[model samples]
Target chain A: SQTIHQWPATLVQPVGSPLSLECTVEGTSNPNLYWYRQAAGRGLQLLFYSIGIDQISSEVPQNLSASRPQDRQFILSSKKLLLSDSGFYLCAWGPSGGNYEQYFGPGTRLTVT
Target chain B: AQSVTQLDSHVSVSEGTPVLLRCNYSSSYSPSLFWYVQHPNKGLQLLLKYTSAATLVKGINGFEAEFKKSETSFHLTKPSAHMSDAAEYFCVVSVGGPYNTDKLIFGTGTRLQVFP
Candidate 1:
C-alpha cells in the first residue's frame, strides 16, 4: 500500500522567517504531488503541483514555492513567511496517468506570529 | 474552467438520521468529481469519486453520492449518520485529463455536525 508522509506536524514561526515543509511518498514511484493550504474555517487552496521531477506548476502567486528533488520527495519552501501564510499545509499524491483521486498526508499546521 | 459549490456551510443532524450534503459544479469538459472528508486537525480523506463512469458512486463509511448530469450536481448521502460523521466535507472538480496535470477545484466546504 502507498502512503504519504509530511513532517513538522506543527510549526510556530515568527513573521519574516524562512519556512520549509517536507513531503515524501512510499511504495509508489513517479507519482503526482501537490501542495495545498487550508485557512481557518475555509477550504483548500492549491499552491503547487508536480507531475515529475523538476516539473512544478504554481497555481497561485504567493510567498511559497515548491520543488521535487526526487521522484517521491516534494518540498514546499518560503524565503520569508507572512502573517497570511499561517494555515494548515497538506500534501497529496496521485497515481500518474491513473484516476484523478488523490491521497493526503497527515498535514503540517503552521502558525506565523 | 471548472468550479464546485457546496451549498451549505454548516449542517446539523442527530445520530441515526439521514445525511445529505449538497454540491453543484460547472465544467467545460467531461468532469471528474470527488468528495473528501476532513476530521478536525487531520488531512482530507477521499470518500468517493465519479469519473464519467456510473452515476451512483459508493464510498467508504457507508456513504454514497449520485451524479445528476442534468442538474450538474453530486450530492453525498448516508442512510444513517454517526457521531463520527461530524466533519468538514469538500466537493472537488478536476479540470483536464489523465495525460496531463489536472487541477482540482475545491468547494468552500460544508461542516457537518452529528449529535447523539
Candidate 2:
C-alpha cells in the first residue's frame, strides 16, 4: 500500500521566520505530489503541485513554494513566514494512471505568533 | 476551468438520521468530482468520487454521493448519521482535458454536525 509521510507535525514559528515542511511517499514511483493549506474552518487551498522532478505548477500566489528534489521527496518552503501563513499544511500524492484521487499525509499544523 | 460549490456552509442532524450535503460543479468537460472529509486539524480523507461512470457512488463509513450532470450537482448522502461523520466536507473538481492538470479545486466546505 502507498503512504505519504510529512514531518514537523506541529510547528510554532515567529513571524518573518523561515519555514520548511517535508513530505515523502513510499510504495509508489514517479507519483504526483501536492501542497495544500487550510485556514481555520476553511477548505483546502492548493498551493503547488509537481508531476516530476523539477516540474511544478503554482496554483495560487502565496508565501509558500514547493520542490521535488527526488522522485519520492517533495518539500514545501518559505523564505519568511507571515502571520496569515499559520494554518494546517497537507502533503498529498496521486497515482499517474488512476482516477487521480489524492491521498494525503498526516499534515502539519503551523502557528505563527 | 473547473470549480465546485458546496451549497450549504453548515448542516446539523440528529444521530441515526439521514445526512445530506449538497454540492455542484462547473466544468468544461465531463468532470471528475470528489468529496473529502476533514476532522478538526486533520488532513482530508477521501469520501467518494464520481468520474462520469456511476451516478451513485458509495464510500467508506456509510457515506454516498449522487452525481447529477444535468443539475451539475453531486450531493453526498448517508443512510444514518454517526457522530464520527461530523466533519467538514469538501466538494472538489478536476479538469478533464489534457491541459486539465489533475489539480483539484476545493469548495468552501460544509460543516456537518451530528447531534444525539
Candidate 3:
C-alpha cells in the first residue's frame, strides 16, 4: 500500500524566518506531487506541483516555492515567511494519468507571528 | 476552464436522516469529478470519484455520488446521516489533458452537521 508522510506536524515561526516542510511517499515511484494551502473559511489553493525531479509548476505567485529532489521526495520552502503565509500546508501524490485523484498526507500547520 | 460549485454552504440534518449535498461543475472536456471530506483541522480525504467509467460511484461510509452529464452535476447522497459524518465536503473537477497537468478546482465546500 502507498502512504504519504509529512513532517514538523506543527510549527510556529517569526516573520522573516525560513520555512521548510518535507513530504515523502512510499510504495510508489515517479508519482506526481503537489502542495496546497488551506486558509480558514477559504477553499484549498494549489501552490505547486511537480511532475518529475527538478520540474515544478507554481499555481499562485507567492513567497513559497516547491522542489522535487527525488522521485518521491518533495519539499516546500520559503526564504522569508509573511503573516499571510500562515496556514495549513498539505502534500499529496498521484499516479500519472488523466485521473486527478490524489492521496493526501497528514499535513502541517505553520503559524507566522 | 474548469470549475465546481457546492450548492450549500452548510447543511444540518438529524441523525439517521437522509443526507444530500448538491454539486455542479463546468468543464470544456468530459471532466472527472470527486467528493472529498475534511474533518476539523484534518487533511482532506477522498470520499468518492466519478471518472468516465461509472455514472454512479459508491464511496466509503455509505456515501455515493452520481455523475449527470446532461445536468453537469455530481451530487452526493447517503441513506442515513451519522454523527461521524459531520464535516466539510468539497466538490472538485479535473480536466486532465495532454500533460496530465490539469489542476483540480475545488468548490467553496458545504459543511454537514449531523444533529442528534
* Displacement of the residue A30 alpha carbon in candidate 1, Å: 0.2
Q: State every prediction's TM-score relative to the real structure.
A: 0.97, 0.94, 0.96
Q: Please write out the lDDT profile of model 2 over residues B63-109, one tens digit for every residue.
A: 99998889999999998999899888999987632323477889999
What pairs collide in candidate 2? none
lDDT of 3 by residue, B1-116 (tens): 89998999999999999999999999888888899999987888999998888899999999999999999999999999999999999999875634576578899999999999
Ranking by lDDT: 1, 3, 2
Estimate the overall C-alpha local distance difference test score of candidate 2: 0.88
DockQ of each: 0.71, 0.60, 0.70
How far residue A62's Cα lies from its native spot in candidate 1, in Å, is 1.4
With a 3 Å backbone cut-off (N, CA, C), the pairs that clash in candidate 1 are none
lDDT by residue (tens digit), candidate 1, B1-116: 78999999999999999999999999887789999999999999999999989999999999999999999999999999999999999999987644466678899999999999
Q: Which ten residues in a row have the lowest lDDT in candidate 2 chain B?
A: B94-103
